[model samples]
Target: MAIAGASAQSQTYVLDKGWEFSQAGSNEWMSARVPGTVHQDLLDHGRLPDPFYGMNELKVQWVEKEDWLYRTVFTVTADQLKSDAAWLTFEGLDTYADVYLNGSLLLKADNMFVGHKLAVKDVLREGENRLMIRFRSPVEETAPQWDTDGFNYPADNDHSEKRMSVYTRKAPYSYGWDWGIRLATSGIWRPVKLTFCNGAAIDDFFVRQQEVTEQVAKVDNQLEINNVISTPKEAQVKVVYAYGEQADTLTRTVVLQPGKNSLSMPAWIEKPHLWMPNGWGDPVLYTFTATVSVDGKEVASREEAIGLRSIRVVMEDDKDGKSFYFEVNGKPMFAKGSNYIPGDALLPNMTGERYARLFEDIRAANMNMVRVWGGGIYEDDRFYEEADRNGILVWQDFIFACTTYPHDPTFLKRVSEEAVYNMRRLRNHASLAMWCGNNEIYEGMRYWGWKDKYSPVVWKEMTEGYDVLFRQLLPELVAANDPGRFYMHGSPYEANWGRPESWKIADSHNWGTWYGQKPFESLDTEIPRFMSEYGFQAFPEMKTIRMFASPEDYELESPVMNAHQKASIGNFLIKKTMALYYKVPEKFEDLIYAGLILQGQGMRHGIEAHRRHRPYCMGSLPWQLNDSWPVVSWSSIDYYGNWKAMHYQIRRAFAPVLVD
Candidate 1:
């Protein structure tokens, strides 16, 4: 094998232009956009209706069941094609996809959460090259596996009749969530790029904070360098950190051999300004640049902004049971915020402006934390970047939610890769406070009466598989990859709503007010150590309601309105729950207003109850902060970015100084 010297450096070309997509067997190819979905492309080409509008979602169900093909022609210059290595990378491939370069198969991708990188040095040409990705239907690809499993795993949130979400590694909410539409999108959902590199390239650059104090902060600037050449080469590594007018530099020389080389350069910053949560202090940040040079000339380099902060989740044994709270800079901090779902059903639409506005809302509300729910995709880098900048903390959950999954070796291997990739990608964020395994799998298995539904042997097998994945595999990965970070097997771990003792320990998801049909006062009565989930649903503002409903569809139970309501008993529950506290309004707009008032009141009671308890109750995050689509769901903010009455009430409740 031949290798290019350091003189070649590295260059990247984005394959985002001149792309087209069509059904797999169809001859028509319309203009397409990379980092977008098939549904989005169809709408762009005027071939599909708006799915979020009244009754249009049902008409677009066929899109997720068919195979789609995407192709793009990109040219490589003669000078660029002479590099030692060329690699093609996809940031995200929705579910099952097969990649081809020119006419040869390049890679088969099965998980949407994991990025794929393929070595394309052998297939390169000096001129134009054809790249095609054939995406199989996630539903069709996983249907057979569900059939062969011989048992129906509990996945109640999957609204499709096939119930095949458990077998696929895509976003669980894409199949269907109570608040989101059932539009399983498939395409190159993220960016695609081709890179030409020389003998070495920077694989990963992690600035791990070893310790943080007012005096000094110690960090290890770890760099993973991949050297493609057969022989060893001497290279100069320089790392520089800059904050305000002050800067620090570290320089070293190392010999890089073939394959991967791990290098860590330990350094310290004196009199560091700590990154603090929303209410504590300013969230100071520093920028760093790492450059690799051969013969004192820069060859490859990486630069990023980072924050130096010490954060940990404190779970200490108390006389009552156990305490669950977050400690930042050695002081216990109460988490005050709401749970976050995917802001849009189609994720690409969550633009930077949207993120900026959302964080502004969070900061204005005096929120210090946000829980990224399990059913959604790992959000884009911009999401965390905004969190880091706003001085907000993030509670991240692995993308397994409200269901049991298969534990076959192949499935576990894919999961392991997904875990490692995400951990490495997100571990450097200052806002990352904890890693939770899943949302409510343990509670569903134990308290949802699975024990009585299946035979003892089958039940044993199911529970064992749960143990292996959550208790063993996930925690072990967190230990190995992201050491010192807080790891919880699942949210509300060892805490079941049925068990009174559960409320005295760890975290809790108190759904008694909604799912249990209890009154809003139950939030005050049945308090837990950490209130992780509790919220009531509200109709969006009338302006948002008009987005999907017309004058004729103004009635609560109208077909168009019901089409927007995905919860089975959503309308009935709202009406019933509202009649108990407030006067049932007659007009459609009044009804929406009344629902928002009731939701706001209910959340206010919960938030006040949690905050009043102080050290006993450490966190209070409602079921959701935003909606996936415009629907009557448990969200403070509507899909159209309208703040419901509940959001304003929440803003008052989460104030640093509460009157209640």
Candidate 2:
């Protein structure tokens, strides 16, 4: 992915080898891997037991309490040193980290949700160089600050995790989600890379296909070039576009100035092939390459693949009714899918093949859309790439979830930067359907006791923060930066979180079954326009449970089993629901197998019920799609990639065409 510019010498080296790690307070250094975690490294060195083992997580809670340090040394060869600039880049840093290169402070990173790249020429030499990163405890990093009204809201530092994940720019699930392991990781969770490039280089580029017809399509691209040299240079930028076997090139000449220069280009395709979602048609894709050359020699290059399509969110409301649906290629269609979360707690270990396999399972289940929940990372690039190729749509939520966030200037500034970076990063994908503000912040404030917890002044500040962040700042940023795509303020709400008849204007999450203990038949009684979130919990298969439970401790009340089950009443709920459809099981295996069928029947009932409502119920994205840890939850697929009974039932219920 090197960009060719005036100087044809651009080298990228993955700095993934020869690393050492230790607890921040300890000097006992251990071998480390760049793209790994403190837990993985500690387990590798036999310093701790498996957190998944029976009642073992309780023993390893020490890992999250202390900061971790990673140090490494790399050499810049004479050839690489010849380049005019050297840059150090980190695709990811778990949460809060301070980086030092050759004993000079480089940068202090506070967000785990985005990547960072910056110049390091002055810190490098022709020989060996040292790099060190100290990751602070996420709990300490996100501690509630003392303000005029004491702590703004209650610090949600629960017993399991000291970190108030809602206060930090880190994955919320890392701090004990209902269906996850609480192993707050620290380290370079993504690849560390060093690049040597001379003069100008293409930093990033994005393409937007605005309109498409049978014979032609209008596509626009924004290309950004970072020129380090102070003197202007004559640069020729060529863009090559290929569809199937046909390829064509377009070239433009421009003067490259110092700092960062961004430009735009337009391209039209003849006889353009349109992209479609699952079951509608084939998801056609095209390849593209951007190259920068000076004096007729290629200096830098970027190659990528994309799909062509026109999409719009139709929302027309009047006094009587409101219409909210996705129109692709001018055709309104029903959306059937499930909410998505982090596929794995060990994020760096989630490979492209893993994403492909999981998504294939989704397609097999006849789902077309997946909601990337706000509590997790924006997801790795491969996820959107596969969604594009597989004809699946993505509903992305900004990284704001359950808890009320601070309106302090520092927090707002960080969120603003985070939004801008991700908006530019992910706006181009054709599979990206819509943008949502948060998961359930409004519900928490209005109904979940957030208002009761705050004083009058604090409540005013909190409400203002919510409005500014979700209502104003986020939407304005999206409109100014990436137009055309629809941005919903929040789910299960209209205009704001509490507008009357919100279900008619936005999606709804019906949780009567799990929270209210309503009968399994309740899904048929009350429904909404878009049934976005509703689910029944079931344990991971017996095989998955064995990973964390011992054979002798298979009973529901056993310490191993209880320790693994997160929801306080999860087992009771499952047992109670299972009895309605199935006879009481005498043994553990029977209960486990019967639980699968019980969950399947309940979820499939809701799915079918939602689909039966048709235009009245435009979409069905159940509570979740996959699991981050092996425990009883709503996920249809288990941690080991085994499909529970619900997977098959969902496949049938969500069939592209079903006969009633």
Candidate 3:
């Protein structure tokens, strides 16, 4: 929400409306919406059928393969053009994008996970300015040239057999998921703004509570500023720290450099109040005003809230092989939650209210933690903000998933930049617990027969990328930037990975039910220390299923049903899973209801089983929390935020107290 701004010194104008979008190599443009994807824009103009509808997503397979272009015209007043620090900021551009201002090339963007800006003061005209953005095809752009013979282990992860997601810094889910369409979309997927700045502007507002305790805590603040003026200027860095009624101010005077300067300052609080995650105590937060003033005139002001809590990881090898858990304020916590993927594939369409509702449901269910899965987009600020307010700890993952990646120097450089940019932004949130390198890439490589099948050359390249990206690049960035959080190489990782299930020292994703098609009893046989991902699939409620399928064709194995259930053997898998516990119902609606309850029963039993092994199994975050579309997936909550029977079961399983 606070990326770019404008005033008399700097003024920001919204450029989110009144745009034209056209397929690349086209002569005509159609009315488009900014902060939207090409798929959404086409849907708005009625050229494309609803992808969420049954049998429609399969029909619209060409959307992800072609390129797209967006053009718009904005006006700038003569009075506003007096300042020299004018810029155009794109908060997000999905995958590859090229921008031109009045036919003059301005910027080329690669990563959809990050944002970029260009100084437009020189090229922008006074009366009217024409802006154009051309988005390249993600598939053609991200195709890897490396040898692919032995890397064919996880064969089901292909985005319609392209298998190009690993090479790009975009949302991996866009390529494909069991529940998602392969709409590897293009266009501006976030807010677009044009800002005009005169002299100085604040770039990054970073605030963190460091070395926190009950007696004293240090509040660290950093303000990165860019001074456009050619001369030196004196500025005041002031922080009004407030906790409850009492307030204090710490101010400093410094001479700013001509271009870029960072001012770091710290303040100590006496009798500090520590913040706590859910079920521990009230999550108390202190507010601070980060401001930059020149000669008593406030140029920039940012309000930030911080919770003073010291988080420690107590991981050690004990008689139980090893132990892993998070200690908040010196008290051990058993994390209770699920994995969070993108709420929707069209991210910009997900509003603050929708984001809040998801977390609200989590809070109501007594959930205290959520692992932002590695395959999805780095959830926007609204998601983390809601987590902070709800006292839900976040287990963040770097954007890598079930496949091995190449260790190309250029690709590594792009990844490093993305890491630096995103980590710096995520570090300030009080709810952030740990940085996981990936979801299941490491475990997949070990368990999916990659070690046996991989050629020596492919193995070498894969290991090089793993070491450099996770061990070297990410850890170094975290150490230099945010040392307060712990870094796990990956979930299900053990120091001695030779024995996958023996070293109960880390998190585990037991897919016995879905992938292995094992019975629910398998969850109890070899219990994980921390079950990060284990789930069963179920179709959504009839209200949602009917949106994609017609009532006349409402059979279980109907073409419409198969179209919605994208996972290989998904419908049959659910039928087999249901047959294990209850009689497979005759009617479609009865079958769906039975499947929902069966899935919930399985998950509820797993949660109780994990909790029964209290000290050994410290946490249980199931496979998924919500779905990206109206599909038969492993989400308790469907795309419309409707709670299935599993959502209610989670409320009981994750309750603060349990009774027989």
Candidate 4:
């Protein structure tokens, strides 16, 4: 549905066609897919083997070491080129890139997590224009930075030889994680767009829910308008709030300055319906349309949907330690869910349909929350939208995990920009619970023996860097941008899973059951204020395994099986624990079934134990809920979206009222 008031506001073109890519310095090019990667493009053109298949992952390791280039030709109208303001925007670029417009150097982008836009009116022409992007190999581009630092940051998850992921702003999992495949790929991983406007444009439009209740709801319709012209212009901003069979209108007329002008219009609605979480009430949403008109001619417009609700994290001190829980609408709520990794190693493969199915599975399994684990890309907008519609809360982590980063001014500035951009993009979502700094980074600083690996001077500098990044920079950014939302320095913030006293306080990631070889029964007794992470490994169902392995490759020690098991201790621990629970089965498929049962029973015990404690233990989010590959690891759902036996058991364990 188009906005009723939209007219000559702006003319935009999606530059997604006529794209091609080649190895840097090579004339041979292949038709490329935007919002894609070099690896996927290579495989699609039959130049490379399927990396996810058995042992073929080893064959495509050369792609990440070579730089790549992508180019496209787009046409623009004479009127568009004559506009007072014209801009080119790339919604995402894979790590290091240099963008050019019509052969003129335009911008250098270093972060994959944020969009980059530049004023290209002077560079763009009326006829055909060439746009090019050069994506430098992430490993090669960051190697010099690592060398200059003179000391290595401990990036255990990076499977690459140099471990330079800490020096790059790309998804850390692309370097490799315990559960993800190593594919440090590069390309134009998102859309490229061009826009033309005359007076001003809507930079951001948010319906800030100031106060909400059954009686009345107060809101401030905030608009950030960017004036592209040289002088002040008079503009009328009109906003219409619409719900089922109801609508309210608010209008403001103001003189916009040469640059960004912040404006807000306060309004109220009587008898407003509140947005509630899963198993609570309905998650009602209302839409708002805002239009900007200059001299009675509409210039820009935006439409957004928001939910009215209030949420806070309650952490008052209790007898054992500080209580950690989320308070929604003045009621303390228990979060029952699991950690979430990326749905696919190749991000573009995760489409809207995939996200819908994933959330549907989450709703069907009775999950109320999902921690978007750090290490993965900040998911597509479709993900959070689904969460809002399904009444599932989201725990978002800043994309830094399992490693320390440089605190140089240049590095910090990039991180700050990344933080602000993502915060602004996601702030209005009702499903967003809080912003966590990173995953396990704080714990790594305290308990991972990082200090022993460096001199006292180096250790002091590293520790101070951590404090600056997590304690000061990230929290300050959160306060400035999304003040109404909560921010945690990191997950398992005040607790270490290895320490006995840690369990009585804050959140905990109890790896003892799997990493420490502790029995499944230990989860029953070693409960915490919040069991944020704990799980046992399991193979995907036999059907999923058969997709990647041949009949002869079904054995645990086969080469094909080893290629799929990314975790160092994955196969060993599964076999070790299997012998303890049941007789080691001779049939390979039978053993796969047994592994699923073993994981299900272990997770069920932990989930039930956490729920049995009720108000004392407020959350139980297991190690993972889904997989990025068909492998033997800790995920209830596999990469093909097949539910392992553990998912069925988790569905039962997460019931609102579970007996025994």
Estimate every model's Cα lDDT from 0 to 1: 0.88, 0.81, 0.81, 0.87
Position 10, candidate 4: lDDT: 84
- Pitting candidate 1 against candidate 2, the one with the higher lDDT is 1
C-alpha RMSD by candidate, in order:
2.6, 2.6, 2.4, 1.9
The segments of candidate 4 whose C-alpha lies over 4 angstroms from its true place after superposition are 1-7
- Tens-digit lDDT string for candidate 4 (1-660): 111132486877777788899998788988998879999999999999888888887888899889899998888778767788988888889988999888799989999998987899999888899988999999888889878778778898875556799988888888777777888889888777778888999999877777877788898888999999999999999999888989989988899999999998999999887888888988888888999999989889888878888888876788988788988876888898899998888888889999999999999999989999988878888999999999899999999898888899989989998998888888889899899999888899889999899999888888899899999999999988887788888888778767988887778999987889888888888878988889889888888888888898989889999888877888788878888889978898888889999999889989999999979899999889998877778999999999888899999998878889
Please tell me which model should have the higher TM-score, number 2 or number 4: 4
Q: What lDDT is reached at residue 600 by model 1?
A: 93
Q: Cα lDDT of model 4 overall?
A: 0.87
Q: List model 2 lDDT by residue over 402-445, tens digit each.
A: 77777777777778878888887788788998888887787777
Model 2 TM-score, 2 decimals? 0.95
> Which lDDT tens digits does candidate 1 get at residues 1-660?
112223338877777888999898887999998889999999998889999889999899999889999998888888877887788889999979999998899989999999988899889787889989999999899888878866777788886666898888899898888888888999898888888887688899999889998899999999999886778989989899999899989999999988799999999899898899999999998998898887666778888788888997889899989999999998999899989998888888889999999999888888999999999988898999999999999999999998878888999999999999999999999999989999999988878876787788778878888899999999999998888899998987878765778998899998887777778887777889999998788889899988988899999999998888877878888888999998899999899999999999899889999999989999999888999888989999899888888889889999889887
In candidate 2, position 19 carries an lDDT of 95
Stretches off by above 4 angstroms in model 1 are 1-8
Q: Could you give me the TM-score of model 1 versus the true structure? A: 0.97
Residue 326's lDDT within candidate 3 is 80
User: How high a TM-score does candidate 4 get?
Assistant: 0.97
**lDDT rank, highest first?**
1, 4, 3, 2
